[model samples]
Target: MATFNVRPDIDAAAEKLGSTMGAKREIKRLPEVLWEGETVEMLATGSYGGGTGLVAMTSMRLVFLKHGVMSQTVEDFPYPKISSVQWQGGMLMGTLTVYTSGNRADIKNMPKDQGAALSDKLRALIAQGGQPAAAPAAAPAQDVGSRLATLDQLRATGAVSDAEYQERRARILDSL
Candidate 1:
């Protein structure tokens, strides 16, 4: 079975996965893998909207993994979901404001050293505006019609193989 949440941030001596996550996960560590295709570009640890955790930038999405006392909250916001991204920070700390299609969130109290750079990177990403196709597995579930169209586009563009497309199509249909 595939392991979940085995990020590089966790100590090697400890388990790579966390109990707060999936059933087959290796516990006692922060998750390393956010998604199958997610390639982490930059990561910064700090307070995200009053919660303590890490913010990771990837080639495909902007991911926020927050750790609570007993569980964790993970948010992977693709560029398509974001309408605007603003970085407000000082030499010590700052906030990242994001406006999505239906929601707006403020990821605040990020360290200046890492936050500023991450904010800049996020700005650049948001400016790029949307990936070519549908959302990843880690992304929040989108509407069925759009999702299907996205899957088709992915297959046509050679981004996903026929088998993968079939699997995803089955999953989408099953969800309905």
Candidate 2:
């Protein structure tokens, strides 16, 4: 068996999340993407597209990570960007879908119990306005400026609409 140097708190949290074989395998890799001080609240194992991965609900966001033999994929949905989460359950498995402004991600074949628990926890978090007890420290002014410049470039390239540029600009400013 492979071992990862996961923090004690994260290991304990994963223990509470579930004990399925998939969950156990995936949870070991979570420390790779988790930010400093980020707390894992829940974890579920499932398939997204053609990849089998784990979705971890943390204090700041939902992270989906897939580790393959030669490549890895990671996707993060910050609480502020998520509009809603939906769960559909059958006897043994379920699907959890997450919606953002213009994107949706469906994680299917999750164990029913894990999916339902994650859905309820996410709903409560959203209901509470997706604010964690302690907000992360503000970014440096240079970082903020860089983000603004990137947003401007996206607008200039027509990658993001004027409305999107404005919204993203305001979010970056608000973080300051």
Candidate 3:
């Protein structure tokens, strides 16, 4: 699946929601619109901490309707369909919206299946969105002098066995 960094504000909100619901939930990196409104936007939901377990989103319209809180369809929110999703830093992120509807849409009383489907859809979409960015290269090798110094400190602190020190010293010397 696609990975994403959870925004602090959104993370906190999801955490709070999880606490209130008393379920095993956590903020995910993926995002989705699933609907279309006047403005267009994506929606994301995960197990916060309370009762909101692994819920998914695929269609904002379906999401709202499932929640029993709907006034229009996907063409009501801001964005329409799956626009984009990718990894930023260490998190998956995406954009979504409703089209042709009003200015805003919401979900409060949707069915569990639909709510969950929406979440699953978002996750799946993220996986299909694109390949994630690569991580930075590893740190360069440290100089032998520094490694010896560290080994000395470790020995003084009784942090290494005599055998360990010898083995490490040999390795350090080989690197020189």
Per-residue alpha-carbon lDDT of model 3 for 1-176, expressed as tens digits? Answer: 22222432333434433232312212221122121111112233322222222233222322321121222122222114434322212123221222233332233332343344444544454455422123233233533554566567556655556887898789767754
On lDDT, the leading prediction is 2
TM-score of each: 0.55, 0.69, 0.22
94-166, model 1: which lDDT tens digit per residue? 8887788878877776666666777777776666666633433644344465456656765775655799889
Instruction: Give the whole-model CA lDDT for all candidates, comma-separated.
Output: 0.58, 0.75, 0.34
Look at candidate 3 and tell me the lDDT of residue 32. 21
- What does the lDDT read for residue 93 in candidate 1? 73
Runs in model 1 deviating more than 4 A are 1-33, 132-176
Q: 1 or 3: which has the higher lDDT?
A: 1
Can you give the lDDT of residue 114 in candidate 1? 67
**Model 2 spans with C-alpha error above 4 angstroms:** 1-5, 23-25, 133-176
Candidate 3 stretches with Cα past 4 Å from truth are 1-142
Q: What C-alpha lDDT does candidate 1 achieve relative to the native structure? A: 0.58
**Candidate 2 per-residue C-alpha lDDT over 104-158 given as tens digits, one digit per residue, 9 for 90 to 100:** 9999999899899999988888888887666555447755765566567556756
